[model samples]
Every structure is written in C-alpha cells, then in structure tokens.
Target: MWQKSPNHQSLSEEEESKALKKAPSLRFRFILAGVLVIGIIASLAINLIFDYSQKLADLSYDRLLRSALLQMDENVGLIRNEVSIDIPWSAFATLAQAEEDRVFYKVESLEQGFITGYQDLNSFPPNPPVLDQIQFYDQMFSGEMVRFAWVQRYITDPETAQTVRIILGQTRLSREEMAAAVTQKAVEVVVLIALVAITLIIIGSHLVLRPLHRIERALEERVMGDLTPIDINTPKETHHLKVAINHFMARLQANLEQLENYTADAAHQLRTPLASLRALAENARDIGYSNSASPEKQHQALESIVQQCDTLSQTVTLLLNQAVVSHRLQTHRLELMDLLVPITASCREQALTALRQGVHLSLECELKESLILGDSFSIQQMMQNLIENAVRYSQQDQDAPAEVIVQVMEFDLFYRIKVIDYGEGIPESEKERVFERFYRGRYDVAGTGVGLSMVRDIVNHHSARVNILNTEPKGTTFQVDFAKHRFDGDNQ
Candidate 1:
C-alpha cells in the first residue's frame, strides 16, 4: 500500500524557528523608535532625580532649623520661680549663617506666656508631645514663603514643672539658591548624555543600514537584463534578503526564457495555417475564366481562409494565456473570494457558444455559500478551459441531446469541481498526454491543444490536483480538488 508522508501536513513552529535561524536575519534599524523611547524615559528620570535632589537639599536645611529650635527649647526654664528665659547667641549664629537669607525665631512658654521673641511665629500647632519630634512646614513670614520648624520641651524646677514650644522660621533664599545650583548641574549632565546618545544613534544607524543603501545602488545602476546575484558580504543582518532577491532574479530569468519560447512557438505554429491561407488566396486570385464555377470556387476559398485565420487567432490567444498563467504562478497573490460568483458568471458567458454547438451546459453546486481562497483570474482561466472543453467535446447524436454538467461538491476537507461530458470518452491511455501543450487526442477534432495544458499549470500553481476519470460507459469526467491552502499566519 502507498502511504502519504506525515510531514505533508501543517508546519510546526519548531520547524519555522529552525528555518528562520538558517535564513539570513533582516534586523530592524532601531535608531528611530529606540531613540524616541530612550529620550522620553531619560527626560522623565532626569526631572525626577533633579526634583528629588532639590527636596533633599531643603530637607537638610530643615534639620538645621530643628537644631536651633532645640537649643531654644533647652533655654526656656523656670528661673527663681519667675519662668524667665535667655536666648542663646550660638543658636542665632547657626540660624544667621545663610547666604542672603533672613532668619527669625520665637519662644513661647505655655505657662510663661511670651519669652521675648516674635510671638506671631508661634501660629502653627505642634504635633502632640514634641519631646523628640521635630515638625517642619511652609508658612508665610514677612510676605514670603518661609520654611518653619516647631519643637516642644518640658522643664522642672524640682517643685513646679512648665512646658514651652520653640518655633523658628526662615525666608527661602538659601534653599532656592541650592535648588537652582543643583538643577543647573543636572541640566548640563542631561544635555551631555543626550548628545552622546544622539551621536551613537547616528553612527549606529549609518553602520547598520549601509548594506541596504548599497543594495539599492546596485539595483539602480544595473543594466538591462542584468539578473546577476548580488555579492553583498557585509551586514549579516540582510543576508537572507539578498539571497531571496537572488532567487527571485533566477525565477525571473526562467520566465523570460518561457516568454521567448512562447514567441518562437507562436511564429513557428502559425506558419502552416498562414501558408495555406496565402496559397488559397493566390489560387483564388489566379482562378482562370475557363470554367463556369470559378465564382463559387472563389467563395469557398474565402470561407476556408476564414477558418484558418480563426484557428491561428485561437492558437495565439492560448499561447498568450499560457504565458500569463506561467508568469502569475510566480507573482500572483491569493485572495479571499466566493467560488460561486465567478463560476456562475463564466457559465453564463459560455452558454451561447455551447448552444451554437448543440450542447446543453448546466451548473450545480452542493453548497450555496462556498468560500475559496485563490487568485480570481487564474482560477477563472482554469475553469473556463475545463468547462469549454466539455462543451466543445460533448457527443452530438440523432438519438439524444449532448449534455455537459459542471458540478461543485463539498467534501470533508476540500472542494471538488467536476466538468462531466457525455461525449465519446477520453481513452485511459491518452488521458495523461492531453494536458501537454499542443498535444491532442487521437480524434481529429479542431482544437489549439493548449487549453488543458494551461489548466494543468493553473491547478498546480494553486496547490490543487486534477484527475481524469472515465465516467459511466460512454462519458469522461475531469475532477479537480481544491484543498485548503492556508498560510501559517492566516491560521493564527
């Protein structure tokens, strides 16, 4: 028993991965998106870092204010039972050590009322038992945004205990100066880094994309019919692309050869018909007046010439169609379309011709909604050739009418189209050769003998199969199976 190979089914991702690994990689030029993303992220990071640095500088200065306020906390005490106090000069010295900043202090005793300091500076409430707690906030002092710190302490006289809050506030000249200096430094560093990144992106982009530019120039400077494989050895990333281009050039060369053969064949095949037409024409022109039937003979000669011309035109058309099918097999794209739409239209178009030949042509489909993916023109060409062959070859007899049936049937995993003709059936031995170009059956029928050949090419290009089967006892059937042709990405 013959068995099909298991590897003929769908592709595995592992195989695709291996194939991609073997092929030359086409790397993306990351200069554009990479630079944009990096620039945005770096800008945000620099701003965050600089802003945090400013807050950190202000926080360190807040510690200084807390220190001076602690000193005031220790200074407030009940002396001689009068709840008196003296301000420390060193505390003021610490607060006064600012570049272009004015400092203020206030000391208030909960029991001693005011201890000879700015009383309005005690406007903010301290956060509970400020024994070891130092609170900082922003406030308005002398019509400017000032940073303030609050502290509280308890002092005992061995008999009476009293508590007071020490609050100190300062104008924000020193903190502003610190923030400006740090941000300026940060800006300079960011600018430098940006310049370095931009330079690297420029140089890297030129280095990476240089191979593509070279390939472009090679294509541009190429002469006519120059399909030589490009020898680009640098930039390993574009290696696969170069190889693909070379393969395409080779295919193009083959197509050009096919076209040349088509032209040569066309000229060679028309020679016999054209020579016969010319001989008949010359004979008609020289038909002597010695016979009374010369006029009738001339008319018959003109009719024969017409028939030969039709045969030549059909031969040329089929050859042209064959060439087009060959070219499209390489470069055509598959499209999603309805199979019934074009099928019905083609049958309608050929109905009159079939009628003229004493043939009854009809179409039938098992499914009403049939979807197929293919190139419409190529599929149409294949269908037209098959059905027209059936129409032309259907047996005409005195006993019964000639009939050609076109049927589309749905199977488990594929679609089948059969063009069945109740004609003198094709013999089993000659069936295979009928698809070869310019090869006809043993019967002396008028045909260009290239229709079935073009059909074979079209079917193979679509990855489908066509089989010839002897139908019943006296007819022939051409069956084509259009299997599922799915790309890997389309499934995903």
Candidate 2:
C-alpha cells in the first residue's frame, strides 16, 4: 500500500477566492495616524493653558486694585467739615504697610486747595468721584514710574451747598506683586501639564502599537521558504494586515507547488529519452565488432544507429524549446505575427510528412492579418508538436478518409489557431490528461508522450489558453488562443 501525496488533493476554489480577498496591512499607517492626532491635541491644550493663565493673572491684578481703592475711600470719609481735618500719615500708612511695605500716600487739602502731607502728593492726579470705576493709568512721580489707586470724597457744610474734594492715594505695589505671583503660578502649571501630557502620549503610543511589534517579530522569525499562515489573531483595526499576509502566503505556496510539478515533469520526460540513447549507442558498438564481415549488415546497423541519433536529437530539441519558452515567459518581447509566421512554416513541414502517411493536410486562415505578443521560437515548437501529434494519430481507415486541418481566426481581442485531426478522437474523460507530460491515450502510437504537453507549456508561457475538443464527425482538435497585447510599435 502507498500513501497519497499531499499535492494530490485539490485546493478548493472557494478557499482560493477568500484568500484573494484578504485585506492589506496598515500597521505603520495606523501608528502614524495616532501619533499625528496626539500631537494636534497636545498643541491645542498647551495653547488653551497659556491663554487661561494670562486671564487668571489679569483677574487677580484687578481684584487687588479694587481692594486698595476701597481702603482709600474709607479713610477720606472720616474728614470733618467744621474744621480742616488733617489725616495722620500713620492712618493710611498702616493700611498700605499691611499688604505691601513699598507704599506711597498723598493727600491735598480741600480747604485751601494746597499741597499737603508730602510734597510728592502734589504730583498725584486728583480722582473724580463719579469716575470711581477701576481703570489702570500710568504716571511719573519723583522721577520714577509709578501706578496707584486713588479715590475722592466730598465734604459738605450744613449751612452751604458747596462741596470740597478730599483726595487719597496709595502705591500699587501689592496689586503688582499679586499679578506677578499669579503669572508665575500659571507658568508652572502649564509646564507641569505639558510634561504630564508628553509622558502620557509616549506611553499611550507604545501601548497602542505594541501589537505591531509582535507582528514584526513573527515575520522576522519566519523562514524564507516557509509559507505557513500567520497564527496571531489581531484586533479589528489590524485584521487587514493578517488578511494581506495570508494572501501573500497562499500565492507563494501555489507558485511553489507549480515549480515542484514542473521540475518533476521535466525529469520524468528527459530521463527515458536519455536512457534510450545510451542503450542504443551501446548496442550499436557491440554489433559493429561482432558483424564486421558483411558490409550490407553494417549498413543496416548504421541506419538503425542514425535513427536512434535522430530520436535523441529530437528529444533534446524539444527540451531546449521548452526551456527557452519558460525563460521567455519571464523576459521576452515578441510580436504576434512574428511568432505565428514561424509556427505556420514549421507545421507545414510536418504536414508534408503526414501526406506520405496518406493523411490529407489543409490550412484555413480566416484572418488576413493577426498579431500577438509571445516567444516566437516557443510558438513554432508548439505548432510543430501539435501537427506531428495529429499526423501520428490520424487513423487510416480504407473506408473513411484521414485528415489534419490547421485553422487560424482573429477576433476583436484575440487570435485563435486550432489544429484538428480526423482520427480516433480522444474520449472526454482523457482530454485533460493529454496535456500532462508522459501521459498517453489508449490509442497505440509511436510518441515520446511529451508533444501535447509541450504545446500546453508553450501556450501557458505566452499567457494564453489551449482547448482540446473533439470535432463533429471524428478526430480531436487542439485550439490555441492567444490573448491580445497592447503595444506601441516604437516600444517594440
């Protein structure tokens, strides 16, 4: 008993289709997008923090100025109208010293409207009572820049409707100091927030992209020839990557299988012809020495020797053609007409040989002009093999005629060449096997069994298709269809 080979099992068309549907990998793209989003958010947050800090500083400074103005108002209201009440420096000084040591106070008398308290008091601007609204103003006093809050009060004598203005002023050091502190605190907070945000972003990015690192490692560990499916089950966002990798592996496995089959077929076909030549040579040498007496006998032996040599030569030629076509399939440029002309010429010679065998050979070309892109020599060899096979197999029945027909038709997008032979046609079941190397039909014929197989190879190399069909009356037809090519004459 023998175990079946793994390659013997056919791949399901559905599975192959699904493999093609696998999504492409986007791990790097995902990471890049995430980084960009994080950067944008961080930038926006930093700007907001700076704006908020400046607003807070402004609010704190305004509040300090309002508090200073309220203190000055309270002191001025205590002045008596009956007599000029001079305010003690200690009174406003105490209030100013409580918040800021660098305090300045100024008061101008309402009675005489004269400079009072300090000579610097005359430099202070008088406040308007109705203009008690908080406003920031700048002034130069004692040759130094200073900012301050001032308030004005009215003292009315009961007997008179006249009003006297008493002005009180103080230095703005406490409010300025408060504004500075608020600004410094806001700067520290912004710095701390930025640091925290940067740290978190770094950590988040790594966590988000950690799965990609696993995929990379898995890929690196894989062997060059290993086409096994990836084992990792990724997140939904990363599933496309899994699908793409699996698709690539499937194609790789398929190509590898095809390579293996080609290699095996080549070995099997070449081995027998080589062995036959070797045996024939050895036998010829033996006969040469054993029967040296008869010249006629020697001549017969020489003819046999020549026939064997011819067989070997044909085999080598077919092999070389197959190899050349396989190579040209990868890298070659050929015009359609160039390939067809040579193939037709080669097959005409084979058709002439068939005529001696009592088989009629006919050519029917429906198109005046046709062209394709392929390897010319391979196409020639393919045509020769098809014609030879037809000649060999066309049954010679005295009652019925034997004939081989070659037809070429050109359609809008393709050119089709068919070789039809009227012989014992192939059974439907065996049609596919005719293209396998070394596979022969039930009919007895002198053949290397590689003729039709070579035809199939050459057609495949040109990215074309071959159809084997039975004609209406009798015999089988091998149809070769060449796909259309887009070409600019200059490029060719």
Question: Per-residue lDDT tens digits of candidate 1, residues 275-301?
Answer: 977987777666644476567787887
TM-scores of the candidates are 0.78, 0.56
lDDT tens per residue, model 2, 164-255? 33333344455456556665665566567656766676677677777788888888787667778888967886789888988988877876
TM-score of 1: 0.78
Candidate RMSDs in Å, in order, are 10.8, 11.0
- Give Cα distance to truth, residue 331, candidate 2, Å: 9.8
Please give the range of 10 consecutive residues that has the lowest summed lDDT in model 2: 160-169
Question: What lDDT score belongs to each candidate, Candidate 1 first?
Answer: 0.78, 0.66
What residue runs in model 2 are displaced by over 4 Å at the alpha carbon?
1-44, 63-227, 232-256, 316-408, 412-415, 420-432, 442-446, 454-465, 469-475, 481-492
